[model samples]
Target: MTTHDLPRLRPEVVLGPALRTGPKTVHHIKDESTGCFYRVGPREHFIMGLMDGRHTLQDIGVQYRETYDRTLGPDSWQQMFTLLGRYQLLDGHADAGVLDRFRQAQQDKQAARQGWLRRRWVLLQPDRLCATLAARLGFAFRTGFVVPALALIALLQTIVWTHTTVLAHDASHQRSWAVAVPLLLVLGWLITMLHELAHGVTCRHFGGSVTEIGLSWRFPLLTPYCRTDDIVLFHRRRARVGTAFAGVFVGLLSLAPVTLWWWLTRDGGPGHRIAAALLLFGSAGSLMSLLPFLRSDGYVMLTHALGLVDLRRESYRFWRLRLRRRDPAARDTLRAYPSGDVRAYTLYGIATLAVAVPAYCALMWVWFARLRHWTGPGWAVVVLAAETLVVAGLLLGAARGRRADRQAADA
Candidate 1:
């Protein structure tokens, strides 16, 4: 069976009694004598090994052999126990009886999902899976799809990645990808350079300097950014809306080349098709850049258009407040609030839900159904349902949150 087939160990119960925590719940654990709390995952296991403080380095080695059936080689059990003791979960040669009950609880819990975790852990490395797929599919055949599909994928990836990085992040900060104008210009294509430029132009039209633009790493990724942090200090609605929509405007501008080419070569061959495909790719990518859930240009526009800095945060708070039987009005207003511009946010959510759910489902269905062959109506019903559910869910959730906020304020 695939590693994904393995049962998942409940994260809440992974530590058990030695956990100093409870089942199906997250709780704090501390050693009464040492006064050290084990807050993280592996540290808990390491701490448990040191409960029997009398176990010598050699004794612990022997215990590992007896229990886990292993020799204490490099990075041995003695070392682990010693490390645990140092972390203050154990006192050297201190009382051991207190831990006996905790130890038994841990051992019982360990047996609950041992094999499942091991298998699932093996499956979690996506790079390895991609490597395997590459080996099986062969790099040459994969490239065959590139002629028509790669451009679209590139557009989508670039759009989403750029939006998440540039317009949504860097532009908000009033920065650019780099100091050099040429590098800045190149970055505009890939890093929301044009998007930010559109913002700068709009701002200049309203009398403002195009500040700095540069690059930064946002952990697990690198991106070009345009800093417009200054304008927000002014609190100008027109500027906010313009800056928020700059990237989208740029994306729209990009459509011109493709649209022109497609129109000019409506009766042409591979060249026309390639141009059309590139257009579709860029268009799709630009649209993805506007997805609100992921903090893209669309998200930025929604935030500014709605005059809310933390709309997602508000949505999450509203959701939580619902569970707690509390009002969400104060929470919604805690961030910036739009004055009767709710439609922008509503449409943004609707558009995203409409596109993302169907696209995601369709992709999944296609992936599964295409395991044996290339073409047919595959897993269509699932795709349609997924799409409808996503759209409905977003619409309902947004409406509910707004209603809750209004009710809370009224009360």
Candidate 2:
């Protein structure tokens, strides 16, 4: 606790990739003993590096000032020491209670890893095989090859689009709502794995590592997720954007053949039937995923492309200031962002809202109409009220986010 006392990080702590967290840069620190990652900013990195046990706090602070031309303030020293001690990053000569908590965290992570082995690792062998195959075929993903490949893919997509413009009006779609909806979601999930695979492959091809490629849940809905967080390090914006939209582009392109077959041979086989259903549902998934409002592949792609993080939240703050408030400080805060980010955020916000408004209304109407026969007028009322509540909640969230942005800027 005193400047005379030397502190050291435990041997089991490791640092991973660094990424832009809003305007700040942060690195991913993994506690080897616990198998979990924590994001820490530049100041924390300086503190962690100094905890080599060779230097006392006073010496470390002096070194930090010399190197960074800024004081390692007394308050930050206390806070950082507490954090390191809590995570058992400090040498294990701290309070017994702190070490006990750290031990419990490690035990909990081991338990979770065991559960992952039982459920996820069993299926992970196939995923690893696919990744190996992809890496071997990595040459095919190069821009020169992918450009022609996408041209062929686009032609196939055009064939289906022109032929199946009236697919919604088809007699095959005139079935029980119960059957179609679930089939759509199920098929969408399976097909979108390939989309995620494309992201992983494109990411790997661009010199980034694939950290995860497995099933991930979003509350009540379960879907496959592929992570390429390391893609942020790419110097080229094209590489990052390509990796981001790789999933959506690959998804739609892969389904083009199925869509064409579904359209061509109306009374096709069960494969055709399933493919047609998937094309319908998966198209929705693709469109939704492209929306910059959420953490879709597109969102992450656009964010990293602009060398910023949390663009959606930051964009929302900008909009809130321009549209609602009149805070000069907030205006200055928004202006502090790079001009490229400011322009991109504005354009993205406008495009998202234009598409999202119509999409949200249509989606809600479909839900109400599909369920109205069973639940009747009372049900319609309930659905409308629910929609209103959801919108209200979103507005409240935006307001809270704006306030949080102000607080962060102040800090």
Candidate 3:
């Protein structure tokens, strides 16, 4: 179509919330028909926002010039149209070639689900349940209630911290490992379920959808997961951030009563011991979920707050290119992104490595210490060496996978 032609977005395509990072504002657009999401900058968002079957490309170009003091040439118009058509975001019927490519992509995705590690079992569809819960308990999401709840959680955590030594002693002194171990496992699993449910319910409370509740196994652990994919479509940053923080908030809040029980009861009593164990383990787990290095609640919250998409991947790519600064192509690619984004990527990459490297080292040290205590120093060293080799191999494999992904994207 020419600049004189009107362009319209498909009815099924939904625009997401505005995410402001420094001087840049990014917007997410989702195609409900294909369940695909795309991130666009302010200029693109402005153009797309006016695509209501009434705005001609020429009209949009004039407005864009007035707004941004920039002109869109024929090449830019062509590129925009190509992007819209490729994503099936246009209102009219797509070309046969585009339809064929889309179908092939879908088929490829379906055909690639052959690995056990990538398999997931959907336990139930929780959309209706989450909707009902959200409707009934919507008041809990209000600022009036949330603020007080957060304050109380902070107070409880402070108390737990103050009495940490006593709680640890009480929990450790419990002689029934067999019983306590199983109870702790069950309690931890239950807490995780509530954590995932909190995300689903809060998403629904904020005009999002929770479609699937499922189980996925990740090597040593099997965990419950809830799909709140619709959070990406929220129009408010507060709603998106709140949804990300909901699980961590609920997980910690759920431990309040147990914390109180541990505090109030006789120190060595069964109730006090059980409460101490649950409070200590549950609180540790909840807090750990806030470590930004992991793809956990904190990472999601940080990304939403910063209004950045694929922060980890982008940050890694930025650092990789940065280390190859002598390469003209790498330097040019780095210069292509906004200065704000480049600064963000640099800061995030540095911070991630700063925190993650030490954390990994500490974890390895702890593992070796525990093994030494159990199997003597020589065996501990042997086992640690073997584990180190395994981890190195895994890291290499991941690097190769990323290289393949980059090549595929480039292709």
lDDT of 2 by residue, 40-135 (tens): 787787777777778888888888888888887878778887777556677655565755676676556434543211223212424354467677
Residue pairs with backbone overlap in model 2: none
Tens-place lDDT per residue, model 1, 1-411, is 321122121121212221111111122334433222234443334334344434454555566567666676756545654644443343333335645554554445433333311211121212233334334534323346534444654554455445443323322332232332344345336536555555545444433334445443432235445544333322466566666666565565655555565456655533344444445445666666666765566666666555554455455543344355444654544334333434344454456568778987777666657543533355455555566687677667655655664464334
Clashes of 2: 0
> After superposing candidate 1, which stretches have Cα over 4 Å from the reference?
1-192, 203-225, 267-271, 326-363, 370-411
Give the candidate number with the greatest TM-score.
3
Instruction: Quickly count the clashes in candidate 1.
Output: 20
The CA lDDT at 401 in model 2 is 56
Descending-lDDT candidate ranking: 3, 2, 1
Candidate 3 regions with alpha-carbon error over 4 angstroms: 1-7, 17-27, 39-42, 56-58, 70-79, 92-119, 175-178, 218-223, 267-270, 335-343, 366-383, 402-411
Q: What C-alpha lDDT values do all the predictions have?
A: 0.46, 0.67, 0.79
Candidate 2, residue 61: Cα displacement in angstroms equals 13
- Candidate 3, residue 265: the lDDT equals 83
Residue-level lDDT tens digits of model 3 in 172-279: 977688888888888878888889999999999987778678886543356677888888788778888899899989999999878867767864656677788898
Candidate 3: Cα lDDT at 297: 86
Worst 10 residues of 3 by lDDT: 110-119
